[model samples]
Structures are given as C-alpha cells and as structure tokens.
Target: MKLRLTAAALLFPLLCGAAAPQGAPGEKMRTEKVLRMFLSTSETGLDPAVASDNATLSLLENLFDPLLRYDYLARPAKLRPNTAAAMPEVSADGLSYTFRIRPGILFTPDPAFKGARREVTAQDYVYSIKRLYDPTLKSPWAYMFEGKIAGDETLRKRYGPDVPVAGLQALERYTLRIRLNAPDNNFLFYLATAATGVVAREVIEAYPGQAGNHPVGTGPFMLGDWKRSDRIVLLANPDSTAVFHATPGHNAEDRALAAALEGKRLPRVDRVEVKIAEEFQGRMLGFLNAEYDYLEQIPESMTDMVVRDGRLKPELAARGIVLSRFPVLQTYYMWMNMNDPVVGGYGKDKVALRRAISMAYNNAEDIALLKKGFAIKAESPLPPNVLGYDPSYRSPVPYDPALANALLDRHGYSRRDPDGFRRAPDGKALTLTMHSEATVGGRLRDELWRKCLNAIGLRVVFKSDKKTEIIKASRLGTVQMFESNWIADFPDGDNFYQLLYGPNAGRANYARFDLPAYNLRYEQARRLSDGPERQKLYFEMNQLIHAYNPWVPLTHVLSGDLRHPWLKNYKRHPVEFTAWRYLDVDVAERARSARGRGGNR
Candidate 1:
C-alpha cells in the first residue's frame, strides 16, 4: 500500500504532544522502539549479489554482519573470528597465514529454513565461500574473492561445472584456513566486507531461491519480515548480546553509563524498523514532525533550519540528537572508459586528454552549488582520508578554457567546422558522450562538463539515466565518461587501488584500465606485511594513476545525517557500515517529552 501525505501530515504521528512511555501500551509496547526510516528511492530487489546499489546494500549491511565488522569509529571490529583473531597477524614465511577462529558461534537461519540451526563451523565458512561461486547460483560478488585464495584453481577445476571457490577449506570443524597464492597484507580487512557474509550448508541446500530474501547469517541482526516495496523489519539477534554491547575504546564510558542505567544489559534498542518512502523531502519532513525517531542522510534543505534556529537545535538536543561530522573516504569522480571502441581508441595522448579534462573542471564552484556547501572538492582517486592521498596531487588543470583550447589545438584538434566544433587534423570530430545519473549534483556536473568541453571546441553530448540503468550501461562499455562514487571498503588503500586497477571484480576500474606496471605495484602493496612498504607502493601507484588520469577524480563528498529531536546515539560511518548497536536511541519517552519543546505555535 502507498501513502501520499505531505511532510506536515507525516509528522503528526510522531509529534502527538506527549512523551510515549518506554514499553508504552499500544504499538509502543515493543521492548525497544522500532526506529522507522525512509529510503528516498525504491529498491528493485533484495538479491545481495545483484543488489550492488547503496540503498539496498545499506539495508543488507544492517541485517547481516560479516565475520568482521566495523566499530563506531570505523575501525576493524571483529564479530565472528575465523582463522585470525585480530588482524596484522604475520605468517612464518610471510606467505603462510594461520589465524584463530571464535568457537561455539551459531548461525541464525531463517525460521522458515527447513534445516536445523546449526553451530557455524569452519566448514560452514568454506561452504559459504564456495556457494558464491556456484555455477547454478552465479552470484556477481563471487568474482571479488576469486584468484586471491589458494586452491582456487583446484576448486575451480573440481567444481568447474557448478561451484568455483570450494577451495577455502575447513582444516577442522573449529578452525578455518585460507591459503593465498601470494601474500596480501590487506586481505584480512577485505574479507570483512558486507559482500563476504558466511553461508550455512544446510541453509544453502534447503531453499535456493529464497536465501537472499530470507538470508541466514551470524550477524548482529536477522531478517524478520521483508515486504518488497513496503518495508523490511530486522530483529536483533539475542545471541550477539556480548559482541553487540562491547564498546570500542572511544565509546567505552557511554556504554558503561547506559548499561548502569539498564542493569548492565547491552543493546538498548530491540528492533529497527526501516520504512520505505523513496523521497528526500518526505524523509526530512518525517524527521521534523517525529514520524521517524531517527533518520539517515538527512536532506540539505533541513540542515539550514537546524543550524539557524536555536530552538529547533535544542529540541533535537533535548532528545539527544547528534549531528556528527567526519572526514569520510568517499569520492565523487568521473570514470573515463579508455577502451571503448565507439570512443577513440585509448590513444597515445589519452592520458593527456583525460588529465586536461580533469584540470578543466571547476572544483570550488561544483562543491558550492551542487553540494549545497556540504562537500569538499576532490582532485585524485585517493580521497584525502586514504593513506596515499596527496594534497599536491591536486589537479594541475585549472579551470582555464584558454588552456583547454590550447591543449586541444596543440594535439592537432584545431580544425574548425561550420558549427565551430573542433576536429582532429584527420577531420574526426573531437566528441565524447558525457553521461550521468539523474541526481541534482549529477545534472549540475553534466551542465558544468558541457560548458567546459564546449569552450575547448569539444562537442560533448549530455545524457542522463536512472541510477540502475546508468550502472548497467557502464559495465556494457556504452558510457564514455560517467559519474560514479566509491567509499573505502576498509581503511586500506587497496580498496581504491583494486577498484581502479584492471581485473578486479566489478572492474570499478570503469576505465578498464590495464597497466601492468600499476598492477605490479598494487600487488606488492597487497602482499607485504610491512606498513611502510605498503604505503610506499600505494604512493607510487597513486602517482601513476593520477598521471594516467583514467578517472578524473572530482572531489571528496562530505555528507551527514540530520536526526529528529528524539533520536539519540544516531551515528553512521562514512565507510558505509551503519550499525545502531552502540547507539542509545530512545524514541518512546524522548519524543513524548519533546512536546512543547519546538515552540509549537
């Protein structure tokens, strides 16, 4: 069912002028209040392998926890240990790794799961790893872990017809061993990804098609009720009690205090209710009116009001709303596919062309207008937060139309036609397709791209697609220059390196960039346990990619969520791991007390 109501109407349910008691009668009686949320855009499906979109992935991350999880500050926080207890474990030869696994952990299979809820074993991890590469399953995420492990080839050969990654073996029921053909210092951190959740053998064999929808996991929360196009309800796993409440060093005191108040039991909230509203304005208004006790990715329009009005800010303050700001490792950049045949071949001057275009962009103006003063201008693939990020690696290309024209002219793109578009000396027009998704910033960037290129006498055709279609077009090589964003999977530079390097899964190297030299450096960075050595390799690789300019890295996008007056402990990491485990958001009493707090006229 769809509800169409204005922001004012939506706020009424949440702002009914009294603090609803904790465990109040009626809908509020549930142990922890369900913090309803909005998506702002609808998801087509919940298939984790295929659902690469952020909105869907965000929901999935909340519902499922990997063997490793991130803490409040976005550091590696182990959930279920496998092989290694804590990271930075070096092997005897620096190639052979042996890590410890947390024993006695159980899997929360779907209640509908016909199989018994068995204890998650080392073999379960192996089977789950293999299941991703199962031929019949054919999950796209399978490629992410391919070729990184030992016996990958042997498993591929054995399960060649069905599963390809059956090689990650269970040395014993309690212990797991992953042998890498080469050493990857960053490999352990990479394994802790949302894409790398462990699967149970019985759960896999029991119900094939319904798994992603009704996935069984060892994470903090389990999938309870998922109504497509409506809402998804995730109930906290009572089993994660200890791990869920263990505070990171930073929040140790806060958790202690909250625990003291609640008899030392952890995980303040019982359930998280995610509502699907698919519009930014509606989500913001719902937060303002209190329909939502908490909200993520608060709209820019409301930010101004929160900043200007002390009353509104205090109302939010009284309710324990926290507006957190952090230096996130997210970059919004343009991917230039160098190998597309439709576009000119990856020319001898391709790097020069890409670099020139990168320089031509107006970073300051783009941030100001398009980002609504929320983002920082990015100039390299290495966002400022990444270890290799070079502030001086900033684009040498200033926003100079004259310089752009000169570069094109010097490259023999000087021939002018009746319409005044420049052509190569061979009369081939210097044209390219500039495509972006239909986002407010995307449209602004498209306009900026068109204006700048036209000044250089380059004929650029502007095109926009829905979010999903744009991603599809990029993979098919139909896009020449496309706008895309990436947040670090882990703190390692390898996440950025592998994505821009040729041959990684999803080949986020949208450019299909193939440079053996760069790949060699990236491989070296991955293998060594030496921090200095890895940092050096990353620096060299960053320099090479910057020079090549396969992607015109625009700017690091700075963004945050604006919570409602009553939403407390609402924090999110820029790394894309959203966990309310440590958050002490109390909607029932807080919202009720917030009545007469906002100076209601």
Candidate 2:
C-alpha cells in the first residue's frame, strides 16, 4: 500500500528506521487493515501536559500509556490497570495510594533512547504528574491536581526551571506512591485521563521546543508523520506488549462483542490516518461517497439528511451504514466573565444584572433554533451517567423576560438610554460583548442572542474569531463572554464542579468565579466521598451559581457516531476518545463493497 501525503505533510525528522508493528504475523499480513478518521479542527499539539484540545488528546490515547484505563466495552465504565501491575492500594483514610509498575514494557524505538530499548519505570509516572503543574508548561489541567496532593505548595512556589513535584514519588524502580492532602473519590478516574499519560524524560530533553511534534512512548502506536493542521498518521509499535482478552460488559451487546474478540492480539489494524477538514460539507460528502470509513460527531445539517426521526434513514441503513446515537457527556453554556467590571462583583445590584441576563435567555428556544431540537436542556450542572448527578434538581432561574425586566428595573439599571437600552447606575453606557465563531452558524446564533437580550432592554455585541484564538483569549481572562461547552474528562460530577473552583481561575475555571463561600463548599465536597453530605454541598453550590449567574447553564448536546459495515467491534466510550487498538478493519470487504476508497490508500 502506497501512503499518500498532502503538500503540507512532512516526514518527522526526529525518528527514522523504526520497526512497524504486525499483530498476528502471517494472517494479518494477508490483509492490510487501516482505520480512517476525520477531525473538524486542527490539534493544539501532542504534548499531554500542555495540550487541552480534543484532537490532540484523541491522538495521544494510542501514543502513550496511563497507569490505568477504562475497560473496553463496560457500560457504567470500569477501570483496569494498564501500565500498573494491578490496581493501586488505597489507604484506609484515602490519603495514600501505591502502584506497582509492570516490568519489561519497552518504549518505542526513538533516537533519544540512545540505541537501547528503554523500559518505562515508576519515576516516569511521577515525572508525568509533575509536568501537569510545571510552571513553564502552564497546563490548563492543573486544576485537577491543585492543592489535592500532599506537598502541592512546593510545586507552585518552585523557583527552579524544571518541574519537580514533591507530592509524587517513586518508592522503588517499579513502585509509585502518591500522598494526598485530602481525600478525592475521583482520583482514580483522573489517573486514567490522557492528561496524566507517561512520558520519557530523555525524550523531553532531546526535542526541546519540538516535544509536541515528536512523541515516544510504550504504546501500540508511534507517531509516523504529521503536517501540523493537515494530516497525521500512526504506525503500530512492533514491540508493544498490548494484548486483548475477554471484556466484561453489561448487556447482550457486550456479550456478543466479547465472543467475537476473546483472544485477539491488539492493534488488528496496521495504521490509523486522521484527516483534518475545516468544512463539514466535504467531510459529509466524503463519508457519503465512501471516501472515509467512519464519521464521529456528525453535524446537525448532515444529521437532518441522514436521519429522519433520530434514527438512520432506511436508504442509508440498508447499505450497512450504522448510526449510533448517544447522549454526549457534555454541557454547553455561556460563561460570564465574573472578573469583568460590567458583570463582576458580589454586590446585590451586580448579581441582579447577571441573574436578569440569565432569565432572559431561553435555553430551550436556543436548542430549537440552532440544534434542530436534537439537544436536551441541562437541568443539573453534571451531565448524565456521572456520579452525584441529581436528575430531580431544577434550575431556579427559568426563562421569563417579564421577570428579567422587573429585576433590572428594581436595580439601578432602570434608567433607559435614548435607544431604549438600559444604562448603568452611574449613567454609563452598558453593552455585553460576546465572542463567537466566524461562520454562518455562529452569526445565526449571535443574532438570536441579540434578540433575547434586546427584549430585556440589554445591549449586546458579538466579536468573531477562530475558536482557538477565542479559547486563548478566554483563558487569559480577556473575553467577557463566550459560548463555552465542556466535555467530561472523566465520568464524574467533580469534573463539572471544578470548572468554578476559585483557585482554578486560569485553568478550568474560565468563569473566574471566585467566592470564598463557594470555594469552601467545593473543598468540603472534595474531601467527602459521594453521599448525602456531598450531594447537599453540590446542591448548595448549584443554588449559589444560579443566584450569582456566573454561568447560564444551557444544553447537553447529542452525539451521532456514523460508521461503515467493514469497521467491526466499534463502540464509543462515554468520557474518552476512540480506542483504536481494539478496533478491527476489513480491507478486502471494504474494497469489494465500494471502490476501495474508504480507510485505505
């Protein structure tokens, strides 16, 4: 098979003469299996410590190893040790954890290895955790480990250029230990995320400024070729120790999948090619013409055509096109910059203004107008299937423009300008500026926002830019407002609640909502395990968020996974990206069915 490359695609100068993996030698050689995928946006980078985008994390899953990982086909997902010899031993107080690293696991051949097969060690895991708090890295995920570890203060106050985390340690060459200052029920789930993926120390020094482009790890795949925003290819690591056994599942679907893949060697596919396309039309048409094997997150425009009543249309279904619809573990909301002068402050008048804005925006109407009635209005801060999600909890602020107008009039914002827009108490002009995507859909969404705010006598404006730039600005605390959507890093309510943690201002807390009362409650909830006590704390926090209106909680959107017939054993994980190693692709069947255009060169 000839590997084609776009003009932008360039061979990585860092690695050469690397051995490509062959899973089951003879029979696997008869058919070249390849999985083709697409991304709507370009990756931020491949450096796990610094990268936060979805595209980069998805690629990192196959290129690196975590101490643990979620079981393949488990419903209500279960954890299994990956690089760890077994599950960590937790102390009775839950403040201490110890793990044993698996021996003889070899990192992929790289120039930085100095002509030796480098084995992953306990210190490597320790180093990876430290990198998350490395001041130089400025990782967005630092919120997860902040103040939770026993000696985290040392990490934050470090003057050295290097990342030295005193809270994490290697008791032996194969034994790792972590001591927490407080108990965290979701700590294991954090260990399984790609942000905690292990990396070789020598490799980090070898690449210097280019570490994100050059990746080396003990996983099933190695980075083969990359073209920045154009394309990326992953070649299987021949020396990987990954193997497949029967997976325990909850339903008949799990039973069937387990039977089909009992003793198969991992990475049944030879290579995975991910293409980045900016336009949904080209991607949708490519899938329609069988140019790509599977399409994840099908846009609503494409969904309307292929789906009639939330299921795949019969004509496409007959062609063996499978549509897997699931509730995405995410929440989309407009985050108000609590630090901005116009909206900031804990005073009654400021809170009233923010609450009025929240009351005027109709979440259900937004879904109907933009999402084509596909998404569900979010009632709880946590999305579905997460621990501590309260299905019975309802928002205190409902959609009511009259009440919004009344609230504004009761406050100092009753004075109307010549244009009928309300003026600030000091008689200064008041305008809300929001950042949005520079596209047709973005314009339509902005127009609706304008209408909603205008009806309540609030002046609103929109700023358009690339999503990446907007995210950067938001992180820097410059953007006053933006349509922010958060996907669960793991299946837990802790992940959602941490978004407003006061100390996490520049990290996960984009709202920059720093209130001493809310911070104390979040800390209290983190220490207690899931129960009525924790539930009560979370409920109080939700009520405070509603009263303060730091965020106008919106919708939990829908996700549609579309795949062709030849891609077998495909199941979508709720909290993580696609697990490519366990998937099997039938090249001959795909070629014979169509023009051999899907997933293969």
Candidates in order have lDDT scores of 0.61, 0.81
Where does candidate 2 have its weakest 10-residue lDDT segment?
Answer: 8-17
- Encode model 2's per-residue lDDT on 499-535: one tens digit a residue: 9989889877888999888999988898777789999
Off by over 4 Å in 2: 1-29, 159-167, 596-601
Q: Pick the candidate with the highest TM-score.
A: 2
Clashing pairs in 2: none
lDDT of 1 by residue, 435-460 (tens): 86565545667887887777677778
Clashes in each model (backbone N, CA, C under 3 Å)?
13, 0
Give candidate 2's TM-score: 0.91
